[model samples]
Target: MQSLSGKTAVISGGAEGIGLALAKGLGALGMNIVLGDIEAKALARAQEIMTDLNIPHLAVEMDVSIRDDWQHTARAAQERFGDIHMLVNNAGVGGGMGALGNLDESGWRWAIDVNLMGVVYGADTFVPLMKGHGEDAWLINVASMAGMAGVPLAGSYTATKAAVVALTEAWSTELADSAIHVSVLAPAFVKTRIHQSHRNRQARYAPTTAPGPEVMKMAKGSAQAVENGIDPELLAKRVLEALDAKETYIFTHPKYRFVTDERSANIAKAFDSAAESPLVADVAEAPMALGFVDS
Candidate 1:
């Protein structure tokens, strides 16, 4: 999808951070924008930014995790711009910054709903529209390096992000024959307000359990990491380059690529052990049975 001029993009979490950076970058290329965010104040600020820049846009205050919200947002976007060409499922939260069992049920549920279900809802809502359009379309799901290299004390965040990465990979294959192209953005860290996400967390999802020292420490460290992270505009530029190349797995910070590589190596070693076992061939199903090609 080389040409973005005059195209329309729907970005969840478009009010700030990486999402807003992408909005600015894409709008610069003459694309119409639909900015959906849960924060009303931030959405208003984003709208002002769009108006100031003379970009074609509609800012919709909507929660990406809600299924009906997507329908409403779609209607608004289509009414304003018509035929969405890009969907960036970027709305997410930093949560469960502790060992898996330490956080209460609310923490887990909140993370699953926002971090994982948000992307699910976005894809379910937009993929059909994108397929109907013959022109080029792009689906960008923002994962994280934490998904690749699971960080301690962030069990929920890592799990949800890893799920997003897997979902993007599956959707990419499913949409391969269609006009919709998919890319999963996995960046190490970025200067964003994500660490302070609790400020916007809904009341229904408030925690019942008090976090332990480890959880508090994790939260503090995460805030520091975010403060020293790279500018989101740089990540946005990288995304554009990746989209131009139609790359499925968009990444940044090559110096940290070794982390994912190391994970891959560990996985391969385990697979090798299993494949070498004589019991493997006895129980293994044919590639066709697993919907896998025998290359």
Candidate 2:
């Protein structure tokens, strides 16, 4: 986990942005790379980038949301490289931006499937393989700044990432005694073509001709944020540093620490004041809107 040298790592969504940046960093550390992406053209570009670096790699087309796709990707990685020492569940999307109440059922399902269940599928498919590889094997899941903090507009995306963060935490706790390490990357805004790419990818995978009217509006808002975010390379470096530290939560922005601290303090105060709390009996559960349901 300290260094990626000689390790065979499978990176989902490795075609561009943070995913490609992480692949390049790992490759520079002398790790063999297996890059998965649904976009053939972008995957080709990614392969070229790795080739320019003279790194050993294989770019495989994969849909992380699909169980069969994940299985095939794992098989392809094993066929090309040996046992995968690390699995990076980095493939994700930025769906149309909208309030939780406005999100459609399809958008909700898409967000949950791609952002949450995709990580689940990746873990189910690759963890067993990683587990057999002895200690030091790692699983890295990319969440977002919204994962820990609730953003008013991006309800679905925030929800999915929160799930990812929570799942990674539980998995880490469960596997603490094992050599396999589970970490989640919770980044703030990062410069990547994720929004456009997600929209484009969705178009390719969609069973319909085009998205609905409301969905298009959401997608546009998301694209704006993606085009104006921070650098992916910096996030990539942070990811490597976190891996070196064997840390569980890899936070991108230092400012986020304040938010986390405030949340923790509020929780502690609430616990201490539970007896005097006024609305404790009204708590109710409902299905959460998550992921990139915005687009």
TM-scores of all models?
0.95, 0.85
Q: Residues 1-295, candidate 2: write the lDDT tens digits.
A: 4666888999898999899999998999999999998889999999999999999999999888889999898888898888999989998876435654565445556678888998999999998888887757999999987788776666667889899999998888777778898999988778887676444446433432245556567667666766777789888888888888878989888876887888789998877687466766345544555421233
Q: Could you say which candidate leads in TM-score?
A: 1
Highest lDDT against the true fold, candidate: 1
Instruction: Write down the RMSD of all candidates, one decimal each.
Output: 2.0, 6.7
> How well is each residue in 245-292 modelled by candidate 1, as lDDT tens digits?
888999887888899889999999998888888988467565585434
For each candidate, what is the lDDT? 0.89, 0.81
**Candidate 1 steric clashes:** 0
Prediction 2 global C-alpha lDDT? 0.81
lDDT (C-alpha) at residue 156 in model 2: 65
